[model samples]
Target: MPNPLDPSLATLIERHTGPVKQLRPTEHGRGSDLTALAETEAGAVFVKAMRDRGRAGGRRDSLLREIAVAPHLGGLAPALLWGEADSGWVVGGWEAAEGRPVDLRPGSTDLPAVVDVVRRVGELPLPEVAEDWPEQRWDRFVAPGEEDLFAGRALLYTDWHPHNFLLGPAGCWLVDWSWPTRGAAFISPALLVVELVAAGHQPAAAQGLLADCPAWSGAPAAAVDAFAAAHALMCRSAADRRPQQPWLAAVADAAECWAAHRAEG
Candidate 1:
């Protein structure tokens, strides 16, 4: 079904971006009420909308966080153009990063750009954004009394799902800043390596790629192992919230395998 923009939101889109010549809704993803491509007088704009009520609050909060955090991201993310969050709806438009989802299969050409972008992004020092600390949130996954090491000054884009990236002539552009997690600089890339494993890379091969990330190289072995174990537990626990998710199950298993591999070192 073509995503039909709400009439109320269309007015706001035109007001913020000028007259909409046409709108073509993109395939709906895991969250958000609407995702569409609009041909506006201003040009192409990627639009996302949330109602700012009920379940919408989660997506709304996520988008708001993206708005807060995107400026610090340099060119690694799509540009947020305009937004409003009063009344019943929260909507924002972004400069469309025209590209395709990244392919992370072993030996894929996209890996280099992916690593480069990850390095640049991982190097971006965490500014004073009111983001949540990941360590506190992941505490439930840590073994009791184990040394706490998840905290750091690095600003992390915790969601590393394959669909969140776009690869074009400009390289990899990370999109969907739904969960702006703050933690150790190595943690984000570490999380992504688990995703790489899930996408069919051997744990060793995935770990090999992480060496390109400076923070990963600086990470303590024990701390990295602990994080892997903790991530496995977190993935398993989160799967409980979305019972019967096949993808979550696969990621949980992959995370466990990576954790086990790290423990072997």
Candidate 2:
């Protein structure tokens, strides 16, 4: 296939890292129009690009958000090597992270590392740039009169799918900051519980995996219950919109299971 990187974009990247020795187009991720790993004089850098027109244009904002939050993430996420916008495209190059996506199944050894990373993320001080980006993705789904339950000052890596957490010799790194949010700290662990459930663990067992996490342990029962219900609604709506995606429907089922478990408690 022709290199998806525009000629001008390639020239721009070359200016920063020398000639691209090789460029390998990668599978599309949730937020990127074009993604690849490019070998350059500076070494391997993961590149993500999005066009500034049509539906793809909206994702440029996500890339900008990731650029802003990258430095503040400490070592929990891959470092952003460089990012720039030119010729109607937003592009970012990040330190190529080496790891395999974590396993969220019950009894998986990767569980401990997953919990550790989520805890560290919750402990990070909220980034100033995210102050106005309150966690509102679930607003429409939240129960009436309970919107305040999701309020907090913690930085949340709201996307909790197994692929988002990579485990390797170096350690676990949470990738993808496209939708990072400022919200109640417990929201991270709670979202993880949903993924665990989707990965074949029972709802109660999933919650147990993160039982020791400070955010999870300290979360108010009422607040967690509200989030569980709202998240289930959100997943169901997404599944409805994309009926062909079995994964979305599966997640909707998991969220429903978690919400029911919380209601029972």
Candidate 3:
């Protein structure tokens, strides 16, 4: 297939990875303009790029944030090899992850690895660059005077889609740090609970999966309740605005179910 990147970005990437033998596009998703696995003389590398224009302007910031945090990720995620911006495009190359998305549904063996990785992520030292990036995505939806329930200094992988957790021969790897945030330790596993519910697990069972994660196990009931409620509101609003995206609606339903479970408890 033809190169999916801008000419200038292709040239820059080529300089680092050598001639691109093939560029197989992956799920670029809504946050990226280009996402491909490139086979090159240097070996395989995953590339994510975005055009610095129109609505992509926010995406450009996300790319920059990912680059900043990549170095601090230790082995929890792929290592950033190279990143550049040229001719209206921003690009990043990382050591390609050889893995498949984890399954979060009930009875999946990947659940153990998922719990381990989420715990490790919470243990990662908060990078100085992210000290000011509080977890506020749920702020508007949070009940008034309850926003402090979400505050903390731990770095959070807020996007908890199962696709973000890749299970490979080596171990589980978390990818797509485009929206990393500093927040309460419980937030990451809590978000993962939402994903588990979306994957067909009952709200209680989903929360059970994370029982090994200290952040989840130790979280106060009031804090979890507040987060579940706020996240349900956020998901519902997103689903309403993007009616064509059925997955958003599914997640919204899951969030509501989880929130109700919390309320009942």
TM-scores of the candidates are 0.91, 0.95, 0.94
lDDT of 3 at 159: 87
What is candidate 2's TM-score against the reference? 0.95
Top candidate on lDDT is: 3
Q: lDDT (CA) for every model shown?
A: 0.80, 0.86, 0.88
The predicted structure with the larger lDDT, 2 or 3, is 3
Q: Output the worst ten-in-a-row residue range by lDDT, candidate 2.
A: 50-59
Looking at model 2, how many pairs of residues clash? 0
Per-residue lDDT of model 1, residues 73-139, tens digit only: 8878888887877556777888988778888899898888778878887888776784553546677
Kindly report which residue pairs in candidate 1 clash with one another. Answer: none
lDDT comparing candidate 2 with the true structure: 0.86
Model 2 lDDT at residue 63: 87
Greater TM-score among 2 and 3 belongs to 2
- Model 2, 1-265: lDDT tens per residue? 1356678777767766788888887654845877888887778989888776644425788888888899999899898988888877778889998888888888899988998998898789998999988888887887676888999999998888778777888999998889788889999889989988999999889888888889899999999999999999999999999999898999999999999999998
Residue 112 alpha-carbon offset, candidate 2, angstroms: 0.6
Candidate 2 C-alpha error for residue 170, in Å: 0.7
Best by TM-score: 2
**Positional deviation of residue 221's Cα in model 2 after best superposition, in angstroms:** 0.6
